[model samples]
Target: MSNDQLAAVFNAGIREFDRLTPQVWGPAGQSLITQLRLRPGDAVLDVCSGAGASALPAAAAVGPTGLVHAVDVADDLLEMGRLVASDRALHNVDFVRADATEWEPPSTVPAAGYDALACSYGIFFLPDTDQSVNRLVRLLRPGGRIGVTVWRRGALTDFARAYADVLARHLTGPAPSRTDASPLSRFDTAAALTDWLTGFGAHSVEVTELSNLLPATPQLAWDLILGGAMRAPLLGLDDDTVESIRRDFLSLLTERDVETLDATTLVGTAVVTG
Candidate 1:
């Protein structure tokens, strides 16, 4: 999809960030957090921090002296994140509406520098993965770290296979291009992900696979795709196509089988040096 199309689809999911943030972000982020080894008063940057999923936790981890700048391209999502911060009385967090792919670290942040940068399940959308990694390095202090999450191979997650089947059945025209074929998708594997991170000047890189159960139920899966970031490609489909896709998804389920979905999360981490 073109950049505009991707943005529109992602923007649709921004409205549901408050409701879907937990499910969408959960285990996918554990590995990243594990790698951070956050310290008191450390500065952190959360790129594509929709509704402050990682930002809120990072803010808490960093304490009063620490600062977290949560950035995303969606203004509405940032607004929601602002409300979340306000409700929690968190003064350490700042929500910035900006394109992570193109944003540069502010002078304040650069001078102070960050100990870590976290991008959870958001790198897939950034076409220039190498450049984004380089920018994250630039935004960090010496020996700073980077943590990222991406979808694992399709076979690892039944939901992924189901979705691919849904798309194949619904879309008649030249099979809508695979979403994972994007330039960044090359990092789906541990070897590839490690190589890319190392290529960006990382000294030590690690990759981990995380899997969890998604709420089972056709409706839950529907909500997941329709109400979350996955909504992007779905929103692009025609109504009839959507129904057909939905039916295909339902057909794949067994008794109450629709009540739970198997999902896996892939995480990659690296530290910058030299």
Candidate 2:
């Protein structure tokens, strides 16, 4: 999909994404910042910072003297982040509506480079993962730290498999093929992520798994499918087909007696060595 289309998909489901962030990625971000140990005057960069889930916390950690530049492609998400920052009286954070992969700091930010960069659940979205990591590294000064989080293996896999099965049986048009590999799947394991980060010129690479058992109900499961990445595939389908998929998907979940959503993320941190 084109960038605009992808942005639209995120925008359409911004509410759901925001609701789930606190339960999943928010804690992961907290863990990341805790590891980075931001100081009072540290300058931080948050790439693909959706609704300031991580950026706001980073701003709080950096305090008034520090600054955080938050970048994302979705205007709505950026605006939401700005609102949240304002609500918290966090003037240190500046939300910019731009592509995280190619965006550079404007004059308002520090010139040398950011002291730390945090990208929670976003690095995998870029078309060129290595290039994007390189870009992020370039924005960091020597000894600067970069932290990233990606969904771990088996993260919502059962739910996705169930949904795909339902979708395949219900889709009116030819159903899309299920690929064994997912873009984000590459970073599901710590070893793979460490290797990727090392290849991207990150030294002292450390990868840790953060898992959360999120309480889930049938309704919440349905809402998740409608409000997250899976939403994109369901778009443009007839209402009947959509409802049927949902019904079947929920039925499968019920049959399996799945009560909790396994939200797992691989949090990777690395430093730039001169």
Q: State each model's CA lDDT, in order.
A: 0.72, 0.80
lDDT, model 1, position 142? 82
Screening candidate 1 with a backbone cut-off below 3 angstroms (N, C-alpha, C), the clashing residue pairs are: 216-258, 216-259, 216-260, 217-258, 217-259
Candidate 1, after superposition: displacement of residue 8 in Å? 2.3
- lDDT string for model 2 (235-259, tens) is 7778888788878888888787777
Candidate with top TM-score is 2
lDDT of 2 at 106: 73
| Residue 97, model 1: Cα distance from true site in angstroms | 1.2
Question: Candidate 1 at residue 234, lDDT?
Answer: 76
**Model 1, which residues run further than 4 Å from truth?**
1-3, 14-17, 110-112, 155-157, 175-180, 236-244, 253-260
Cα lDDT of model 1 by residue, 1-274, tens digit: 4456655766676645455566667556545776677787888999977777778788888889888889887767778889978999999999997778776777656484788999887876676667766776787888988888886665225565567666766665544443555764688778888887888788779888777667666656766666555565577567887787777777775522455665566788888883
Error of 2 at 62 (Å): 1.0
TM-scores for all predictions: 0.84, 0.92
